[model samples]
Target: MNVSIIVPVYNEAKTVERVLMELVAVASNDWEIIVVDDGSTDGTRSILQTVCQEIGVAVVFRDHNGGKTAAVKDGLELACGRWVIFQDADLEYDPRDIHRLLAHAETGHRVVYGKRRGSWHRPNRWVFALGVLGVDLSILLLFGRFVRDHATCYKLIPRSVLTSLQLRSVGFEGCVEITAKLMRSGIPISQIPIGYTPRAMSDGKKLTPAYGFRALGAALRWRNWRPCPSPAEHTGSSSTLPAKRANSALN
Candidate 1:
């Protein structure tokens, strides 16, 4: 498969089916949709099973609720695609933007983030602004690069790049963990402006102030981190195929 689109779903029963249908509509044979139902209790799993089966996508069910990080890690283990992209079950982000991210991939960008245009539509604008400022400042202090949307769900990463990182955040902080590790690994991340439709707190917007603090802590912890050497780095083996392909595309 050329693309592995990983969708980590939680208690999003009302929207999961629609999200799957949209993904199926946009995906071709070269794209594989991997849906991880993260122990959803709101009948999301049943909807996923029917929709995934009908659409011929792979679905994994966890016994209990794990964070998005755990679901994403499990999906990565099952991914066979050369490139990996993350999609949320919530309808805040549009599946159509995948094509735009893939276009940059065609030009050999290993890491691409769909930057949300303007502020989030949440009630408290100052809270959202503060969160963004904290994340961007943390990234700048760590990598000397200011990323507008470090917590964006639409991060397109090469399979090789994913394999190189040792991710440990089990909560929403996983976004910071991935971004920090990728920046530390000497990878340049490209950002493309994308649409966003923020959901209200009553509409299952799960991110909390505590999650923001945790993400900031993760960023601080990984500031001076370095990746362990891969077998390809040590022995120059074929395990480097993805990286080689990415580099060739850049040239």
Candidate 2:
């Protein structure tokens, strides 16, 4: 497969169905879309029945509400794509950009993040802007590199590179985990500007000022850490993706 798209959902019942439909429309036969339900208290699980009927789509219902990181880890084990990307259950991100990310990967860019054009909305924009700025600036100071937008939800990573990142974090902090580890690994991140329709807090937007602080903490804690060697790295087996393996060489 070319890319595996993992959709991590909590209680996003309103938008989850539409998101899955958009993904199914955008995905080619070679792509696999894995929808992970993080023990939704809402009727999201029922909505995912639509996903089961769609081809190239699969759903995994977690036992409990384990945040984005844990849900992704669960889906990653089943990924067979050369590259992997995360799609939030909300409507903030565009699904058509999946092809844009894949084109970048075809050009051999191992790590790519979709650059948001800008934030739009009222007081909600202020909240989001401040939190993103705080987390981004903190990571830049700690890692000596400006990542453009570490808080962008449209990060595209090679499956091999992702496996070697030793990613660990829950909720929004997972973004910080990926950014810090990649900076420490000396990987260059290429950003492509895209559109975003920012949502308000009342619209079920989960990120908050506390998430920003936790993200900064995650970045500080993970900085300078190296990825532990997987069995394939030691044995030189070079197994398929979702299998234990070392990182792929970047362009």
Candidate 3:
């Protein structure tokens, strides 16, 4: 199957090259990399141009920084792959997980998420856990399914399913919107445990308490948002996405 790896970048010039190199080394020829430069004012754009020329990856430099959802949507519009992987430009997440994700995808899974599972024993950990809990509760009250980590970054979806999703959030809420939409749409998704290394704010980690609240608010508003069936459904492909209107429709 053709795989389109979508990397949404913003001020990640420091690590984007390494991520691209890993993709080139591990992915097959039919796999295409689409790097969406979300209006990086740093050297990120220059580095992306070089990578595009050298590695034959498609680079999209948006007119302005539209956030992660827009970048992914832009790539989806241009993707010709049978499946799509939403990857982070930062090397925080491992590229090797792609192989694991494909393992599930190849076995007839329509949606696969790399779920993060680890104990948070520190005081700050409780605070983060509380935040995650609050969001999960909100999602459950509104929709019905419980999402362990509604904000994880590693999600691999079929191209047809992804393309049919109409996303509007501009911040961390993108994660909530996508997950809720997928689950509500009734698409069967499998979760594979993955490692997550928390980064400090100084290390270019952008999620903040404010973004968290915004995400929760977005999830509440989109609680009724359902995903529409993809064009592939009529063709009897298991890869076809199910219809959902809210994140709580995960079951």
lDDT agreement with native, every candidate: 0.80, 0.77, 0.75
| TM-score for each predicted model, relative to the true structure | 0.89, 0.88, 0.85
Range of the 10 consecutive residues with the lowest summed lDDT in candidate 2: 242-251
Q: Model 3 residue 57 lDDT?
A: 69
Q: Candidate 3 regions off by >4 Å?
A: 117-126, 233-251
Give the alpha carbon lDDT tens digit for every residue of 8-57 in model 1: 88999989898889999998777877788788899987776667666667
Report the C-alpha displacement of residue 67, candidate 1, in angstroms: 0.5
Error of 1 at 44 (Å): 0.7
Model 3 CA lDDT for position 110:
77
Ordered from best to worst TM-score, the candidate numbers read 1, 2, 3
Order the candidates by lDDT, highest first — what do you get? Answer: 1, 2, 3
- Which parts of model 2 are misplaced by more than 4 Å? 54-56, 229-251
Worst-scoring 10-residue span by lDDT in model 1: 233-242
